[model samples]
Target: MLKVNTENSVRYKGKPKKTSVNAGRLKLIERNKEKPDVARIEKPTTILRGMRLIDPNEVNKNMICSNCRKQLAFNHIVEEKTTGFHHIWTMKCDTCFTLTKCHSSKSHFNDGHLYYDANTAAVLGAVHSGAGCNALRKIAMRIDMPVLSQETYKRYEREIGSLIEEAAKDSCQGAAAEEQNLVVEHIDTLRDKL
Candidate 1:
């Protein structure tokens, strides 16, 4: 067995241990330690520019900032068409740089490819409300909005169905376990009475 007390010391079987620091190396390290440049220090405000403003409506045309309640100006128009069309009017609040999006209608935007974006919350709402794919399609058609394929609606249904099934199973298991504990206690009390 071998024991070494120095941090730089190393030992091997049947070999002598060596530990030393070169004087020239220490001088070289000291010479290379330079102070950071004062000019390179970043201003904190530069980072704040990348943050999103509190009011999203500030991006729309002639809209008031939802936060500051100040009138905003139209920045520009973002028009694009894929399945349908989109004419998005952008506005910004000069005070806080809050952006807001303005569309022609809440149901549909300027004949865009799709009627609504159908975010997670909206899709889950439709599933919970029992709105079938055909019903959704009919509603879109009635509103003159571009309708998505039945497959998309089916996919949403499947996703929501699985989540519901999982929650139901978990609840059933929890109830069963609680009931079993209660039944065991009741049986024990009846046996004592006998």
Candidate 2:
């Protein structure tokens, strides 16, 4: 900044004359301060958990929910606890409580969604709820026909199939809801144009 004296001279030096500045102006000047920390993003809340599986190395790349058939992640397959000789790896989906498996067998079936009838599933020693379904499927799936009963067959015939479908649709709902909100807001803003 340049200073002028009463004699109309630009050189108004007085032992480095210091001018006072307003507090607000001082604040406006940028300061050399430490940078802020970056925020960490969180994982989705709906991710499923508690699934049981067998072989991680042999997990199917395309294996997904058997009911909804939504493609599942390899890491999401939870291991089921069982009394067996072969080593197994398992996981449970966080979004839905669907239990999946990857059993170590001779047939070479990789990581696949182990689905079971909700009704006969119980007879096979697997209950529908996380109460212990994955653990049951690991043992029962190997037994052909799994001793299906008349009542069990009639009851869970449709439920197990629907579980997968519902899960798939649910996985897409959160994004759809956000999109729908944007659309609604846009329509409201453009109401005068219509």
Candidate 3:
């Protein structure tokens, strides 16, 4: 599970305000291998690290360049997250200025990977310069996709790629079938942000 914001540099926001279930419920779910009713903090969980987590296995076809207002290059996927110190967050485009809010599951991958705040990164910096400084930079140096560990990366693609393409195809068909013009306020507002 993941969440992101398009407006401000706030890391993953929109985590639920609080969980309806208590810790006991969580433990029960864990024991049953069922999903937990994860809740967000009073505010959104601060993103301590940035992840490019991408669907590198499948080609991306529903690419939209916020700056261009045109379809982006096929197979183009960009993911930027907050990392390093001071909540360093990034997106694919440098021109994004709009804001958005969304809520998602809190499932971090099973991997030990986790987001870290500047303080956390600093502590880590003492151990690894390149490791603590900039995850975006680090990931780029390692592979073409931001989330590059061949096996994990493929899983990432499998999870997100199909969802994106299916959405695009459904949107297109829906637009053709309906004469009503849906006011996509966010898209219009975020169009200039690339």
Candidate 4:
């Protein structure tokens, strides 16, 4: 017969023995415990309507040189061109001498060239609201904002006017079809009753 100690049995379970904590790790834990828990929140990008005037300093602060990986200051930027509210900036990286072109607004390829979405929207809104170019110019002047030229507005109007007309026709046709279907349904109900 094998003699076994019941107190030191293989199946005996007890509280785990505490291991010696490293002084450096213990100090780090204590330091972390003293500090307040901070929740980091990220800024959200939202699709904005109307217009917003952004400071040049803000734009400069956000701009980084692609080649040198350095922030491009306002002095390093050269104003290349301005198309309505859209502005083209040519940045010369001082360290690498690399020329980088940046646009204030995104451009869509329309026709043979590029067109700013803001300019198109402005024209469309003006036409739809019956405000016209004059009213838009007046509003822009009052706000000290860049006004779209009458000629450019006219060009966009010409391009978008046809599309608006086509959309209106489509809407009318759909409405007529729906009306006819309702009439047919009503006639079928009367015939069923008779």
Candidate 5:
């Protein structure tokens, strides 16, 4: 049923004997092999064609460390191609390394690609300032900047419109409070005069 060699190696029925290599030596060899790959960070093995470059420092500034509440340090950009191609910027906290900022260059809702530049922000601002989609489309014709489609613009508005409305309502509430205080002061003065 089983065969035993002179070296005490066992072989099962019709099965070849298993060869053993020292686990420690195998791990050492693997570590040696990985060193060169780790050293060559300039030439990343995973390369993405037509990947857009974004300012790492700008992204770092926007990211906050979840652990220490400090700014996150930009580590690198990685391109992912699952449903669609997208660039993800990886960041981590320098002090504790507890916080991670994994930002994607594509909208999660499939509205469009990420836009960080002032020109794109300005176009979005115009939309936020009550400009209609048709008007923005006409403006896009006059300008060289790529304007988002009316459908995409509507999606963007739907995604962030609640936040904008909340901020506006907060501002209005503060203004109303101030106005109420001023009116109460005037009423008090009038009562004193009476």
Candidate 6:
């Protein structure tokens, strides 16, 4: 039986030696170590940016007449126009008889044409998420939410599809140009070495 000495054996008490890190990797590590500024983070004014499934009773409870400062009754909603997921409600104040137009989503103007933000977003989101109009309609139906017609969905899909295709072409061209530049630089370096 062989006995080993434990007391005389030198144990490392100093800090562990760090392995060499690449300059780019070191920068990433330093960046990740930095704490984000909590004060700089802004909270969204509304619950969600796009369409939200809100109860009609909740809207009635929170609604106030702009002119009279009285609670607007749910029954006072004179007209409602739904475009895809977006909704515009025209309400008449009982006290002041003032008509107020409420919009569920903001409007964006492009080439002098007004487009609902939510409606555009819905089509874009559907395409990005690999979901079609049928899928969206089924989900809406299941949730008891108002569903957009196939015609309306198809119209937005066509418009957005063209835009997406254009963007993809631009991106591919940019990437090709960058790759060509890199190849040219590499050839120049080889010529210099020769």
What is each predicted model's overall lDDT from 0 to 1?
0.52, 0.46, 0.39, 0.69, 0.54, 0.70
Cα-based TM-score, every candidate? 0.37, 0.21, 0.22, 0.58, 0.38, 0.57
Better of 2 and 5 by lDDT: 5
| Best by the TM-score measure | 4
- Model 4's C-alpha root-mean-square deviation from the true structure amounts to 20.7
TM-score of candidate 2 versus the correct structure, residues matched by position:
0.21
In terms of lDDT, which candidate is stronger, 2 or 6? 6
TM-score of 3: 0.22
By lDDT, the best candidate is: 6
Q: Please write out the lDDT profile of model 3 over residues 98-139, one tens digit for every residue.
A: 222211112233266543323333334433443422453455
* Candidate 4: tens digits of C-alpha lDDT, residues 1-194: 97655543333135332233344556888997887445533333232334544445535554678788887764666544656665556777889988777555455464668554667777888999999999988987787667789998898889898889999999999999999999787997878889
Arrange candidates by lDDT, descending.
6, 4, 5, 1, 2, 3
Candidate 4 matches the true fold with a TM-score of 0.58
lDDT of 1 at 157: 60
Which candidate would rank higher by TM-score, 4 or 6? 4
Model 5 CA deviation exceeding 4 Å by range: 1-123, 192-194
Question: Relative to the unseen true structure, what is the C-alpha lDDT of residue 104 in candidate 2, on a scale of 0 to 100?
Answer: 37
Superposed Cα deviation of residue 139, candidate 5 (Å): 2.5
Worst 10 residues of 6 by lDDT: 42-51
Q: Pull out the clashing pairs in model 6.
A: none
How much lDDT does candidate 1 score?
0.52
Give me the displacement of residue 101 in model 4, in angstroms: 1.4
Q: Model 6: how far is 53 from its true place, Å?
A: 5.2
